[model samples]
Target: MEEERGPIECRVRVPATTTNFGPGFDAFGAALRLYNWTTLRVGNGGSAESLPPMVQEAAEAFGKAVGEPIPSFECAISGEVPCARGLGSSATVRVGVLVGLNELRGRPLSRGRLVALASALEGHPDNVAAAVLGGFTISTDDGQTRVALGSQLEFVAFIPDMEMETEWARSVVAQTVSLQDAVWNLQRASRIAAAICLRRYEELSGLFEDRWHEPARVKRIAAWEEMRRTAYGAGAIGFYLSGAGSTLMALAVGRGGEVATALTRVAAKRGLKGICRRIQAENRGAKAWLRRPSRRLA
Candidate 1:
């Protein structure tokens, strides 16, 4: 009889995501170069209670989706994505663990199925879709669509020192909106999606305006108008909130560094105290691979 393999390891790399994209609330998202990695090793007898809440939830969902009992495995996560800053840090972790678990079990779930699972856990599909598929994604309850962006585009992320919980942010939004406001958002969102899909970057200007979420969330961010003016003054084509709040993103072309510096200075001057990073959209999404096998010692 062949000797049984012992304790195989799998590693998954999932990119961070920025969703909402102004008027496209819960609809648009794009994967960024920032990443979170999760490594899973089987036969370690890891307990679900010990894992972070998000990881545990992901593990449970994975088991139920695949119709199998989750195996005993240790999980380790490391990455640059900051938590609760409107960047899809939670999605990255959830995707990482789910993909890592799937890889170790020989990938029983397809990428589409994985996206569906992650979206269900996240309570929204935008961030999870982009994090899983890469590129620009438009997500809805029915399905997700992706568009590849060019190298010329750059995203200047203004990450604040403070953190805003997604749940709290959602609580602040009005339960209902005016018909005019709803129509305004719909018009802009449709145009923005078309602009991105067609690569008409110039047309993206002024399309980021929204009457849905930003109007309410902007009040919570200190010096929002001044920072937005600074970003535009520095050659940003479009500016808006990344996800919920606390991290504002500027869409720029060749002037990313100028925009980043301007946003940083303005934020500090206004007492917000934050940093700006110039990042590119990641075309490739989450990836998984097995580590070299190691034998258990007797």
Candidate 2:
């Protein structure tokens, strides 16, 4: 055991994701470059007696789900994804935990299996699908099938000052929406998917029009209209609420800075608090790289 005093460490790159694009509701998901890096160190091979209690609990929660014993080690996590926003913070964390442990275990979990488990933990497929697959993925409620997300589009997600929790926000949706609104969303969702496939950038702005959820969400969030105008006027192919509220994605065919700057000013003027940054979607998902352990930590 003294020969294994040190731990095995690894790094995972988990990208930020955009879900519920326009009217896709629970189906569509896109992966982005904005990511969280999770690094973990596992204790050397020892009996089940080697692990600590908190580490044991986390490992049990994450390990049994993967059909394995709880990892025998301690973990440290740090990164950019924020919690409680529409930006999928929970997905990032869960994926990070799974990836960190899997790496230490000689990659016992395959990529596809990891995605399904991540989706199960997240309670939704959108965010985890995008994070794991690194592109667009369509997942069902059970999260068994993770189809490759087939979109290579460039866009920016607008994050607003205020954060909206999905639970609280979702509770407000009426049990029955009008038929006209539902029809509008169905048509738009179809068109948006088609536009993405054909690479019809110009058609994007019109296709992003969602009559189902955004209209209602926008009414409550003060930052909606101004951010929309700023993105629209800046020649964004389209813009929409990223997930539920706060983050709004603007399409910039080639005008990345233009959209970021314009949205920044608009959000500031409204007396809202938030940050605006440019991000591009990665057709690929979670990735790991092996490097020499840092001397400082060593």
Candidate 3:
């Protein structure tokens, strides 16, 4: 094949999300206040000079998976999520890359298809489902969408410093959960899904307390107790594991200055370095802006 370089760029928006919302494991998910912005370009491209490592890592992974390397591209990846902090960092990058690539390829893949593809690679649906579909999503195995809760809520995430590999966190759980614990998750997940679909944001608080996973993982994360205590003291409505552990997330009253300050103090005192984000519960999913070819209409 001859060398070719007809450059094109695509813009994409993807949001942060919390999975396992206390009780729902690999089942319940919620979109949060941060987002990943990126543009994929083919051929000669400009520079960001400060692309996040997650972004670079994600691009390389995408290239390997797709059987084609990421062509010369100008990509700017910036977001509030700290690396390895359980705030859907990987999902956002994956969605952003897939969105850009699809637009470049003349929009060949459907969003649903792309969602399944990303979820398969991510090894779970909690994060990717929220990033793609937005709002709340419930997926078991892969094909089943038992519940799809379109966005409807207000949330402010108190992200704490600390990191844990998802695999390491996963290793903490019991191979078999107690029968009662299983039933408890089932009930809360059902209620949470119903509340999301009905737009009953107020009821979400009850649904966020889990009986299956967070307790187990919190044991491994050093800052778990202090983070939770401080968040509740900060007037958070509810809280749960964003994904696995270490990256403590809380659903606070609002994404306002006071709430942020309270969480910041807590993080500082605890020595966990990270930022606070006023994440909007968005269900708009992945949207792309196409860069039209520069033309002369003289």
Candidate 4:
């Protein structure tokens, strides 16, 4: 945590993100208040044996992107964001590593370049872009990412006991969607951006319905239909699968606690052990800073 400039050290904190946002699949994303933290200490390239999988993957990607051998750095990774639940835990690691290394290397890569590298590493830009840029984001495959600043909103996150890997969840979705379904999502995605930016919470209920991914993937989560109904019955403005899914997000203006309580109760009654958390949107994105040691007294 020291701020004095001395031996090279960098710390990066990246937020967890929820992407797709119902009909906005692979396009819309918002950064949540939850975050993951990673720290890097520069030295000779260290052993890769013990590094976390995401960290390892990040390092490899960074080396390739920068056209340099990975430096020896001891890394300590920790965070509150849950993994394998579509919360961008992997993005946190990938982004943190790239950002941390960029700092240690005197930041040769521009932010845009870094983002492209991260997106390429992640196989898409949705979650990584939001985690890197913060706030609400819409990113395309062409390396263009946009952020829309707006009033913050609350979310009641129902984290189930089970884990659904993103790859598996994605595999269940159909590769080709109907033109009508595509049109259905296009209209709603545009409006969703306005609704979120304008704080029109009421407009979200209808806009949050999706025909592309949810119907196919919701079956993977235990009692998802029942939970959706329960959330609506409990006064949620709208709800959607958080990413690919074992975690559900219920949007609310002032009823976060009530919504969370209701979801937790329903989960318990259904013999599914899980907890609910009420979190807010984070406007700022990932942050990286050097933590140099304090100079000794002369």
Highest lDDT against the true fold, candidate = 1
Residue pairs clashing in model 1 are none
Q: Which candidate achieves the best TM-score against the true structure?
A: 1
lDDT of 4 by residue, 1-298 (tens): 1224435678899999988889888888888889999888764235787687778887787778778877566788788999888788888889899888888877778777777888888888989888888888888877644555544368789888788888888888888999999999899988988777676767887678899989988887777888888888888887899888778988887677788888888888888777789888887888998866343211
Query: Cα lDDT of all candidates, in order?
Result: 0.88, 0.70, 0.68, 0.81
TM-score of predicted structure 4: 0.90
Residue-level error in angstroms, candidate 2, position 224: 1.0
Residue 72 error, candidate 3, Å: 7.0
- Write the residue-wise lDDT of candidate 3 on 230-266 in tens digits: 6667667666777875656666544345556777787
Model 4 worst lDDT window (10 residues): 1-10
CA-RMSD of model 1? 2.5
**What is the C-alpha local distance difference test score of candidate 2?**
0.70
| lDDT value, candidate 1, whole model | 0.88
Q: What is candidate 3's local distance difference test score?
A: 0.68
lDDT of 1 by residue, 52-114 (tens): 888889999999998887876677888899989999998998899888888777789998899
Question: Which is better, 1 or 2, measured by lDDT?
Answer: 1
Q: List the candidates ranked by lDDT, beginning with the highest.
A: 1, 4, 2, 3
